[model samples]
Target: MNISYKFFSSHVCRICHRSINWEPKSPVSIASASRLYSGSPSPKNSKSEDNRSKEKWWSISNEWKIITTIGIGIASWFVNAKQDRIHSRKQMKMNLVSSQLKELYGPLYGNRIVAETSYRAAMKEYGGLRNYLEQARKERDAEMIKRWRSYVWTVLYPLDEEAVDIICKHAHLIAEKDFPEEFDTFLKHIARMRFVMEQWKNEKGNLESTKEFTEDDFLEDTNSSGIGGSKSMINHLQLKCKHLRKQQQEYVEDISVDNLTLGMLNKIKI
Candidate 1:
């Protein structure tokens, strides 16, 4: 049972004027003495080193956390901005579709219906004149001459002009794809009607100027003059009005205002 003592003393060397370490002789074994004097760390120093290492690790972790947080924040901002833009564009498309529906149903469709009604009424009046003319011709009634002249001047001329103008003005609104067959037919008929009305207007002016406005000139079956017989012109107009009215009615019944929603527009694959 050898006892070990740690000799703790500081001595000065007179020759070198430096502090010297002195170890007193102990009964401890040489290995134990050597172990004590060796450069093994104390508990305090080890604890301090460990604390510094932990602090450095924590600093690096905090820097990474801050960088990750900034990255996430920027990414989130970009995602939200992209979502906002997409939503805005979708809303704009919806609004545009809604406006087109209103125009198609309310103004364009409504005006065309009105014009058709006017045309139908005018045709009916002309049909009455045709009946009157036929009966007068059969009966050799001279009263029809006065009535026919008055009818052509007052009712027929103005009505024809109005119908021609309405058809021509609103013809462009008819989407070719929407009513392909009817649209093409309508354009052709409108061209004919416009031509007929223009010729009648010009001829009437010339007739009035020359004092040659007579029933024989109007009722003649001749294509040389601008008026290719008034009866033929009136019959053609009546047929066109009937056909157009039927087409419009069919179109109105087929298409629905509800069908013009955003869902339907989305289906267009734009």
Candidate 2:
């Protein structure tokens, strides 16, 4: 009897075969095995890792914090300095305006008082002269007429030129919005005062030149003549002046550095 036997072998891919053939390696020693399995480091390695983590980064952060604080302080200082400069400039402008106002005030109040007093005295002297002229005419005394005419010329005092000049020189400094009507009224009265003085001077010259004076000759310029008319004008002017003075004083007193700046800025805006 003859018997036949057969042998078979299994086959796999190269990469898969290699993977299946590979065996997991065991740690070299018990200590290494303990470290690998426990997921812990040796004492020496742990200390080294701790040292690496403790690098100078924390000190760098502290330095950066200090630098950031200094930068903020410097920026704040610059801002404050700019504000101070602006404030100083504003203060300087205010002082200049205030000085100009002071100069104007001195002459305005002082000279106005003098002009008012002089006008009142002139009015009184004019009445006296009119009475004396009537007496001289009735008695036919030429000497008495001459005396009264001289007294009339001597008694009338002209308004101060310096005061008018001061007002004109500094009128632009005043804000037009502040008491505009009163300001205009004052200026008109001042002009009228000058006109009245000119008229009186002309009349006085005529009285001096004529060899023989008569009532008709004295009242020749009927339209613009008469000391009585001048007195009425002066009285009206006095009322306007009194109101103007009160307004001006109040306006000047209310002025302050802040308000002045605001007013100027408002004008610029317009």
Candidate 3:
């Protein structure tokens, strides 16, 4: 006999008024099982059980992982290569600076001393040295001035023995505290040699080459020309003559073979 239920409309069995259980379950066709049955809810009404099946927890695919690992490695390699290129460029710039500085050692050393003195004399005014160099470049080309200024700046940057000597040789200005005694002694010796040379001036009386004079005679300041007032004046005049001679010798040596430097010639006492 058919029974009616309050929730479900009618033709239900009294023992089990549930509509789905009272009616016999229908056999699903293959087509319906594949399509309609897949969409239908289960009689058990178990959603948690269906969700558990999806959480099977399987291992990741090796091929997908391989692709990801390879991709990361390639990215890292590119980044490293870019970094290496930047480092190479920086090193190249530094090397160029060092070479230019090396080639300019002699010239720069001289310019540095003069520039530094000018800077100091100006009461440490404006800025350190660039200011002084700009001031001195009125008559000269700016490039030459800059090179000289740069050289001076480099040598004066550090008060090492070699640098001080280089600066003092080319200019009158020197930091007394930084002067080298051995170098001074060498200069004095050269001056003495120059003095000794003057005493042996060409004589009219002698036919054989020229008559010679001794060191004691070379000390004479008999010339009365050009501020020849006192012993000091005579001494200064003698010194000037010697300095002029030394300079002439320098010009000759500069064009000589093997690029013989003024400093080297002086050191050699040539």
Candidate 4:
């Protein structure tokens, strides 16, 4: 069986849902049916009976075999064609799904998914594009994931570290500002309160980091270069990361479906 491809991606099967017809009947040739009994004894009656039996089996077998094979071929073709159609549909569906997911979650969600997917797919391709994979390779990846993930949703594509850091600054905004319920809308009020607690925990890290970099902390060091302050800054950053990780674990704990939040989550559009 042959399938038609969209030469320019415009092929549509308007008749895909049409029904198939059963076979048309045709009369059998008697002379052909009698030839199998040519060598029989009693020449007339025995030959006729023997020929009749052979012809019956042969006729039934051939008719069914031909019909079965044709039916099988058509069925196989239909199955294969349906699989291809489903795959194409999945491709389109994933594209839309990713976008809708991003849109509903906002740019942060889009950045996270695209950067993660592109990173994962690229890692499979050449063990990760840590640096550029040559000009051509970079272009190919950009184009492919573009078709795959809307080309990272911008020329900048993956948000830089600074951008991510900026986004991290917005927990208060997420808590205070309006958001669609889609962002964990099913979560209970207690869950939303827990989210708020998690937000406070994260902000606590930022505050601690800021505190560690105070002028007093710097002034205590006599060194002109303030190497003590530098090390303190590194330590502060590590503490912040550790705090963030702990908060994440706590957030996951709070949001477990087995135990849920009530009001805060009920407010969202999700």
The TM-score values for the models, in the order shown, are: 0.40, 0.44, 0.24, 0.24
Give the clash count for model 3: 2
List model 1 lDDT by residue over 15-71, tens digit each.
234325445566455555675699666556789999999999999999999898778
| lDDT (C-alpha, whole model) for all candidates | 0.48, 0.53, 0.41, 0.40
Clashing pairs in 3: 108-151, 112-152
lDDT of 4 at 270: 13
Cα shift from native, residue 178, model 1 (Å): 9.0
lDDT of 4 by residue, 116-152 (tens): 5555675475553333233323344333322322222
Best prediction by lDDT: 2
Error of 1 at 111 (Å): 1.1
Ranking by TM-score: 2, 1, 3, 4
Q: Which stretches of candidate 2 lie over 4 Å from their true place?
A: 1-57, 117-159, 202-270
- TM-score, cand. 4: 0.24
TM-score, cand. 3 vs. native: 0.24
For candidate 2, write residues 202-238 as lDDT tens digits: 4555544334655633332311223233344345435
lDDT over C-alpha atoms for residue 135 of model 4: 32
Model 4 misplaced regions, further than 4 Å = 1-44, 97-270
The CA lDDT at 98 in model 3 is 41
Cα lDDT of model 1 overall?
Answer: 0.48
For model 2, name the residue pairs that clash.
none
